[model samples]
Target: MTIQWFPGHMTKARRQIEDKLKLIDVVIELLDARIPLSSRNPMVDEILKGKPRLVLLNKNDLADPKATAEWVQYFADQGLPAFPIDAATGTNVKEILPRVKQLWAHKIEAMLRKGINPRAIRALIVGIPNVGKSTLINQLAGKKIAATGDKPGVTKGQQWIKVGTEMDLLDTPGILWPKFEDQMVGMRLAATGAIKEELLHLDEIALFVIKYMVQHYGAGIQERFGVQDLPDDMDNIQEMVKVMEAIGRKRGCIVSGGKVDLDKTSLIIIRDLRAGKMGRISLEKPF
Candidate 1:
């Protein structure tokens, strides 16, 4: 399936972030804990080049704890300080201030040499849409400094939120790359609600989620839906049908003819899974 999604504003946002990079000492980049590799914007590396970086695996509460640990290690292997955090509940947020200070030790030293006592380190919170950047900032700031919502593109412009005496956060609009080159990356984004629902095929994305879960997660579907194990030869669509039927029966999604409403059932399952109702699920393993 061809995935086409490039908003005109994203181009302007990219330019804006590049222009603002000079004003910050560090870049605190957030990636979805569930799909860190896919949710990461490739352009961030080039755009924020020469800046100290922190890779925050946001929404950790919704992801598998073991997988979250692996992702932190995977990023650390690349010489980046990564941490898993639950932005909504404020878990691990206390670590952010200290971590940012540690990551910017060189910059802090430089300021000390210049006689800037207790210099405030400026950090820009960067991430793709719906990755929980605003929520994280609010938690850090201890107030509603940035507007947040469930949908993508809630942040329209840049704003500075002072967290404490030593740290200030620049919140930027959620950005996506100009194009998604990989089909898997596109599907993962869709599955996590990063891509708008109107832009995706619900049934197709749900099937992808089901196939991945069955392969890597070991019987999550059978356990959750009380369905028999899928046949070894069963295809993704067939397995998805079984899952939909089970969910339809459980949720009472029946049509006039008493048949399970496949479309409605598919949407319900996808929504629940994305909303973390299906349990702590992670889409990719650390490489």
Candidate 2:
């Protein structure tokens, strides 16, 4: 399925971010830990214009630890410091300010030499919709300063939040690019809830999730749903359908005539995957 979602507000958000970058000391680029690369907005590099950025792989609690490690190292190789954090639980969220301070240490030191106290670090937090950007900001500020929700496009405007006396965070609405050159990227984003569910075909997203889980997380899926026999062929559509039906039966998502409700089943599978009920799963790995 070809999936694309770029609302008019996103264009306005991009422009707003550009206008605020001059006053910002660093950019906090949040990403979904399960699908790091897919959740990353490609336009960020172009828009930030080489501003120093720290990558936080949010929702690491729901991602395979092994995959998260590989991703952290992958970004390290690219000269970006990437950390695994769960904003909801506030795990590793406190470290963000210190790290941002580290990035702007030189500027701070220069101010100190001139007998000037360095002001709070001005940081711009950005990411695609539902990637946990606002959640992280709220965690850092010790209160609910930014609007957050499970669905995409929740934060419409930008606001500056004081993260204690150490940093000032500019919380911007999540921005997605105009188009996705690779459809799989869109599929991954959809599976991870970064894209709005209304804009996607639930069956296609469900199948994509099933195929990936079957290939990379076979035992996890079986154990989660209590399915004994699973098809090994990822390319077999019928086998995948059977798997879905089995899960549907297990979850009691049945319709009239005893037929499985594939649409409801799709929602269940996606919800389970996102809620970490299927275990710590990473949809993609560093290659």
Candidate 3:
């Protein structure tokens, strides 16, 4: 499976972000908690070099709490202040400012020493699409300043949003790399809705989700779909097919010919996973 999704607009977005980087004091990088590493745009480090950064593990509400913690610690070890946040619900939104300020303290001190009046910190909000950048920005601004759509590519250009009197934020379009060096990264992004659903093989992604759940979250699936026995091993296609058929039959995703509807069944499973119906799960956790 070769997965690569990079539209031309993302190129334009990256160029704009590079140009806008000099105007900001810090970069607040948002990442889907379920796929912190995979959802990260590879170009961020180069584009945001020398800028103090804050990483928000957005959608922590839907991710395994333990994994989220490990990821936070991992980022902290790398000199970043990373926190778990549910941006859609405004969880931990208030806590962002202090951490970012703390990161920018040295610059603030330098300004004070130079007899320069300190200016409000400006942070560029960035992340992969649908990873909650817009939602987080809206929460920070206390209004819907940035477009918050459930799908990717909602916010297209750059705009500065004032958050209170002391802070300014630049909301940029979420970006992914031109090509994924690892195919599994693309799969993870698709599974977490970071990439547009129409751009990938939803059925393959759904099967990957189902397989992962069966391995790490069987009981949760059993409760959500009322299937007491999901196949324990997904490596066997026949066994996996049986499990999908069972789910389709139970969920009433059947056609007039009395056959299981793969598309509807796939959507049902994927939706349940995204909506937290299958319990908190993390596809890739830091070791």
All candidates: CA RMSD in angstroms?
4.7, 4.7, 4.8
Give the C-alpha lDDT of model 2.
0.84
Judge candidate 3 at residue 63 and give its lDDT: 96
Instruction: Candidate 1: list runs displaced more than 4 Å.
Output: 1-8, 146-159, 171-179, 234-236
Q: What TM-score would each prediction reach against the true structure?
A: 0.87, 0.89, 0.88
* Residue-by-residue lDDT tens digits, candidate 3, 60-122: 999999999999999989987899999899988889888888988998899999999998899
Q: Candidate 2, after superposition: displacement of residue 56 in Å?
A: 0.4
Whole-model lDDT values for every prediction: 0.78, 0.84, 0.80
lDDT of 2 by residue, 100-124 (tens): 9889999999999999988989898
Best first by TM-score, ranked: 2, 3, 1
Among the numbered candidates, top lDDT falls to 2
Total clashes in model 3, counting residue pairs 3 or more apart in sequence or in different chains = 0
- Estimate the lDDT of model 3: 0.80
Residue pairs with colliding backbones in model 1 are none
86: Cα error in model 1, Å: 0.9
